[model samples]
Target: MTADDYVEQASEIFVLSDSFIRIRELIDDEASTIDDISEVILLDPALAGTVLKLANSPFFNYPGKIDTISKAVLVLGITEVYNLVIAYFTTEAFKKINANQAYLDDFWIKSIDCALLMKFLGTSLGIVHAERLFILGLLHNLGELVVHQLTLEKHTACESNDINLLPWHKQQDILGFTFGECSAGLLKEWQLPYNIFAAIRDQDIDDLSQYNVETQLLYIAKRVMSKNQVFKGQSLDYSSLVTKEQLELLCLDKNMLENAVDYCDLERLSLLAILNPRASMLY
Candidate 1:
């Protein structure tokens, strides 16, 4: 199957939920009031519940639980609320995929970690639309999700454990396109800003000279997340991929990178606990 084939196939399997579609349309139309937006959110009980749950999650760092939708909006801010809505909507696609739970869990953990790290870096850089950057980090691996789903359908006999053994290009070849490319295409189709599509499309930090601070932060965050020495079976030299000049440009250093990783891990664990409230044994 080609990338276009997966795109065509995904269209059939993944219809954007009505609530998400409505919210996206309203936001695109520039409906400026909280009530107008909140009404659209409240149309789907599941989406609303997810928002409130996420608002109370340790990820938000709220002092106390927030029960109401209006309070969630107030606490998380308008951009964050929109991000949560999209996240809740997009998670259904992952749920429908037959990928291994452990792989999916790790992917989500890493993505969330990247999002937290990007948000931190964006704030430090005084980047506008920090929350949007966070959302981009969270959704950056969406193409992977699509590829995994489509591959499962094509290779039903293939075991999950064998997936990692396939070369990166081979995996993409089998699936018709790499996740990075597909994710960019999908986000573009969704009418997201050009920078977001570009950032997701090009995960390489070296190729990000033209991107703004927000995109640069996301690009670096993805590189950090992808640097799994143990999982990849090779020591990733971040120095080679991310030069000293680039780090200085971003106002980052070894210490800052280390601290960001630590902070991101903590946030990921907190969010995981919220997602799996009963998984105390796992923790």
Candidate 2:
């Protein structure tokens, strides 16, 4: 079956909640105030508490405490808070799926590692609203979940864990399409913005010169995730894993690459627990 077939089959299970839909609508509405967004968020106590926790988390590094949804909206800005909500609700949505617990745990760990790296790299490059890249990095591999859910027989083959062979390459060899392409297809089916789905669609391409900076960042972050063997507990040479040309794509240096790796290593542990779907079950 084609990626679209798989996406169509899994669409019902992978969805944004009505609360997130309302939050998106409010963000798009010109007349909406901080109170407006805050009201929608507070209706779901779990979402409200998570928002406040994220606002106070090291994710933002704000100077003072953010005790309420309204304060979070004012400090993190409506757009950023919207992105955080997307990140939260998206992860939470996966809680209902009946997949292998260990596999899901590893999947989220690698995803968060990629996300923290993307945020750090984007922020270092002085990109605006770099926080949004976290969602991109976090969600880039959701197609793998789709494959695991819909086409269980092919999922293991598609994983292609050999370090020498890149993941997208192995996916294409087995499934005739990369997981990134499948991921992009699923996001587009969800009616996400062009900037988002488009980047994920093309992230597996050999050359990223023609794509946007976010796409380039995804490529770099994925490379780092694979090379560092994140959550695999093996230390690899950072310099050897990332090439000069790859770093130069974003005008970043080796030091910045090392720092990004370090940042992910330091932060991913806490975020792994916070973002895991199981953790959200307590809320």
Instruction: Output the number of the TM-score-best candidate.
Output: 2
Per-residue alpha-carbon lDDT of model 2 for 1-283, expressed as tens digits? 8888888877788888899889888888899899999999999998898888778878778899999899998988987888779778877777777788877877787888889999999999999878878888888888888898878888888765455676777889899898888888888877666887888888788677788899999988887787775324555555544567767878988788789989987877667656775633322
Best lDDT among the predictions, by candidate number: 2
TM-score of each: 0.81, 0.91
lDDT of 2 at 259: 94
Candidate 2 residue-wise lDDT at 162: 59
lDDT of 1 by residue, 20-58 (tens): 777777766764677778888888888888888888876
Model 1 regions more than 4 Å off:
62-65, 152-177, 193-195, 229-237, 275-282
Output the TM-score of candidate 1: 0.81
- Assess candidate 2 and give its TM-score to the true structure: 0.91
